[model samples]
Every structure is written in C-alpha cells, then in structure tokens.
Target: MKLPINESGLAASQLIYGCMGLGGGWNRDPIQSEHITQAHEVVELALENGINMFDHADIYAFGKAETVFGQVLKEKPTLRENMILQSKLGIRFPDEEKGLPARYDFSKSYILDSVDGILSRLNIDYLDVLLLHRPDVLMDSREVAEAFHQLKSSGKVRYFGVSNMSAGQIRLLQNNCNEKLIVNQLEMSLDKIGWLETGVHVNQVAARDNVLPEGTLEYCQLENIQLQAWGSLAKGIYTGRDLENAGENVKNTALLVQRFAEEKQVSQEAIVLAWLMKHPAAIQPVIGTTNLARIQGCVEALKVTLSRDEWYTLYVSSRGVSLP
Candidate 1:
C-alpha cells in the first residue's frame, strides 16, 4: 500500500486521508473544540489503518480544517513524526476589495504569505509538501520558482507539487524551478472518466471531442510524477447510491460494483477505488469522508485487485457506452 513520492526514496501510504471534512463546515465559522476531537478520531483511524499522509488546503472549510488538524498535532506532538503533512495555497475567496472577484493568486508574495498563514494555523514549522492549489493564469513561472526556492531554503517546505494543472503548465513551472514537481492532483473517478476516455478514444473522432487535456496522464507516468486523485469515488455514486432513486446507468453501475464486491468479498468502495489504482500511473486516491466505517471500507481497496475484464466492465458501465 506504499507508493514512492519521487526519486527522493521516500514513500507514503497509497491512500491519502483528505482533511477537507475534518472541520464542521466550509464557511468562516470559528473552529470549536469538538472539531478538534472529530479530527483526532479521524486521524487516529487513518493512522491505525496505515494511512500516513494527510492532505489539506488553506481554503478547506475556510481554514478551519487546518486549525482543527493543528489542534490535534498540538495535543499529540508525537504524531507529527509518524505522518506526512501536505497543504495547498493560492486560492483566494472574494473579499471586500471593490470590483474584485474570487480568484487564484500564485504571485510570489501571496505564495509566501499563504505558507506562513498555513504554518501558523497548523502550529507546525514545516510541511512535507506544499502544492499550488490551482493554476493562476497570471502566474509567472519565475516568480513561483523563487517562492519555491525560498520555502525550501527556509525549511518551510520539503517538496513542491501542483494540483489541477496540465502537463504543459507543469513543464513551464519545472523549467524555472530548481526542485522537481513531484505530483499532480486531479479529479478522477469511475464516473468522471475523461482521464481514461481520452486515451481509450485516441485518434478517433470521439477523441477529438473529449474534454480531458490529452497526454497529462501519460506525461505524469513518463516523468515519474505521482498522480493523486481528488474525487476518486465520484461522491459515492458508485458505492452509496440507492438504486430506487438512481437512473438506469447509475443503478446498473451500482449493481455491477456490488457483484464485484461480493465476489471479491470486499466493500463496493474498494471495487470503485481499486479500479482507479489498477492504472499504470499508480494513482493515490484521496478519501475525504469523515465516517470511520467508510474510511476502513476504502482501505480495503489496497487489497482488492481488479482483473482486466472486471476493470473494463466497470469502465464501460460507467461510460454508459462501449469504448469506441
């Protein structure tokens, strides 16, 4: 269940526990002590199940999620050495500034200032990794490289990566940075199958109409960049659906997932996630559920390996049409 982070020779759990759900809500609500307890329970469950990497972002619950996680670290400082902590920055919510809209900011100053805020909120001096949450169209690769250099030199961050970025964008940033970009996080799941569809439909008329950015998956595999999947379960469409309320395709997919789960003696969630892990790129599914049972169920995916036919069945069922 361990995957290499890069050539750094360091490895982390194949399943990452996303901290977005740790905080009670996604607004500007004040973090409560109960939130700390909830985070502690979830963190303990993840660690107990061999998940050592925790993912976070500055905007998760408007920063309350990081605060709750930080409180857990404060109460149990020894746990820090047992985990890899990663957080993201560069997403800015709309503020009081006149005529300003919610946007991304990868400017050197914003990146630097955001890291400090993340550290202060998390009560940590350093992060195992820091990801630029999203692409800022106005970003200057040179400025990003400078920020990365300063963060690394100051011992504030150990590794750098990007989320929701294309291969070209990653190359643009990598060319200017001294450090290698180790990972790319994207929304990939059974239902959200564009990442797979584009490749499957290559050179065909259907491929021309595919919305996925071509070559991103292959590029990550070629460059040895880890692929982290954000919405790996597609919000429980494959595993948690009520067939009576679902459409024909969803109901059929759920039934197929159930059949596989029964045959393999695993949870439906494991079937859904294992299908993703079967890819050659070694995708790491980030599970954000706060439910302990669901977390344990997802961990079962580490043990369930789908056969090629089973994989294709699920893929075709999800696509609602045979591969072109």
Candidate 2:
C-alpha cells in the first residue's frame, strides 16, 4: 500500500528513519568525527533497507543531529536528489539565563527563523516537509499562515504538517493556511493503544478512559493526511527487551509476539511493526533504532502481513482486555 504522501507528489518511503538516535547522545557537546561516521552508517543502512524518508527535529541532540547529518550531505551532495528530508520545529527548551520556560512557539518569526536554522544545519536548500513539532496553545493561525506562505514562496519548505496534534487542532490551523497539511504524526504502538481503543470502545463505558484525540484517526484518513507512528517499536518491550519488571500483560504480549515471530519465521521486530501497519490508516512506522542489526530487523516488517485474527489477537493481548 502506498503512503498518502505519494498523493502529494513526493515519493516517500513506506517506513521513515527517525534521526532522534543520531549525533551520539542528546547533549551540548560538539559533534565528533565518530558521530559523523555513525551518521553515514545509519544513512547508508536505511537507504539499503528501503527507507529514504529521513525524519528530524531541531532539538534532537541540541542540533548536533542535524550537524552530523550536514556532514553526510557535505560528503555526498548527490544524496539530496534521492532522499526526502523532513524536520520539525516549534519546541523550545528552557533557557534559564533568558528566564524563559520551555514552551512551544508558532510565532511567525520563530517559524521562519527555525526553518533557516534547520536548513543551515542540515546543509540543505529546502525541506521536503516541515512539521510543527507540537501544538502551541497560544498559536495564531494567521501568523502561521503568513510564515508558511513566506517559506513556500521562498522554497524553504515544500510541504507542511503537524505532530501530536488533535483533529480539531489540525482543522483550526488548516482553515487558515493556504498549504495543505499532508501529515499527522502521533505516538502509536502496541504499547500505546489509545488510538485503537478510541475506536473499539465507542459507546462502551471504557470509552471514557481513552485519551486519544477524538476523531483523529478518521479525520486524518478522510483528509488524506498520512498518519506517522512514532515510538512505533514500544521501546522494544514486545521485541527483545528485558521483561523482568514488566506487567503481566506486556510479558504475555511479548511471549505472543515471540510465538508469532517463530511461526512466521521472521524477526520479532517484523511482528511488532506488522501489527501497527495492519491498520487501514496506512500508518508509517518511524523507527529510531541506530543498532545496525535492529535496523535490519525493522525492515523485515515490510515482508509480513498479518491476518485479521492475528492482528486482533495481538491487539487484545497487548491491551490486556477483552473486547466488550
């Protein structure tokens, strides 16, 4: 199944390689030569594994992630043509010296300036897509619209999207922006089942417990907004993480995942990811693993397709609740 992003004329990959794990660790330290070497390995591995869409954020590793990535671009300028590069903005960390608390910023100047920083750090002329990292409660749609207009007109960004936004939030912003919002990324995984529970528990007493932004699933689907799943691996809980302190449900789910992996003759990562992909939303899993072996395991997901019964069994096991 093709991603909804393809409709926008950008040939994005089925899976996205999240850059959160790059640039060594999230610190204020300078990017070392080793970091650049690691970035090269990750970029090459991802391309070999069929992931050409790279995801990044301005705050990842205090901007060193983009810096190391920029080194990769410096080495291989030709990679610009084959890759679809995406990055996010709007999340500002605390600055005690400036007496500013951590906050989300969508102001026009912040938006425009953030894009420039992103481009300069990544050594790119423009972004394939730029997402508002998270909703800024005080955001002004007109200011955002104006910033997007400038970016689009100047070719700074080709597409716009959001992360961790609700349906109403997206609608409110979309109502004012001239550009189409083509992506909505949220935390979705076997461990994070709120998105699925919102639909399944409808009209039931358990519905009240679901905190997923209402109508988000259906809204994104109807609007042709590609839904991207971050934390899609659930921190490896269902794959090979130590379950000694895990709850009964998670342990059981891990065992079940192992069973499926054994029966299907694929890696555990394949089973865990295939379950999320089984959703009709065509959700693209953003894998953040930097381990070369684990990266190979994640790519195995593209080969497996779960039957309906298999999907439900895994879902129910992970939720630790019977369907009402």
- Number of the top-ranking candidate, with TM-score as the measure: 2
CA lDDT scores, all candidates in order: 0.91, 0.92
Q: Which residue ranges in model 2 land beyond 4 Å of their true spot?
A: 1-6
For model 2, which pairs clash?
Answer: none
lDDT of 1: 0.91
* Local distance difference test, candidate 2: 0.92
Total clashing pairs in model 1: 0
Tens-place lDDT digits, model 2, residues 113-154: 999999999999999999999999999998999999999999
After superposition on all CA atoms, what RMSD does each candidate show versus the true structure? 1.3, 1.1
Which residue ranges in model 1 land beyond 4 Å of their true spot?
A: 243-246
Q: Against the correct fold, how does model 2 do in TM-score?
A: 0.98
Please give the TM-score that candidate 1 achieves against the real structure: 0.97
Model 1 agreement with the true structure over 65-96: per-residue lDDT tens digits: 99989999999999999999999999999877
Best by lDDT: 2
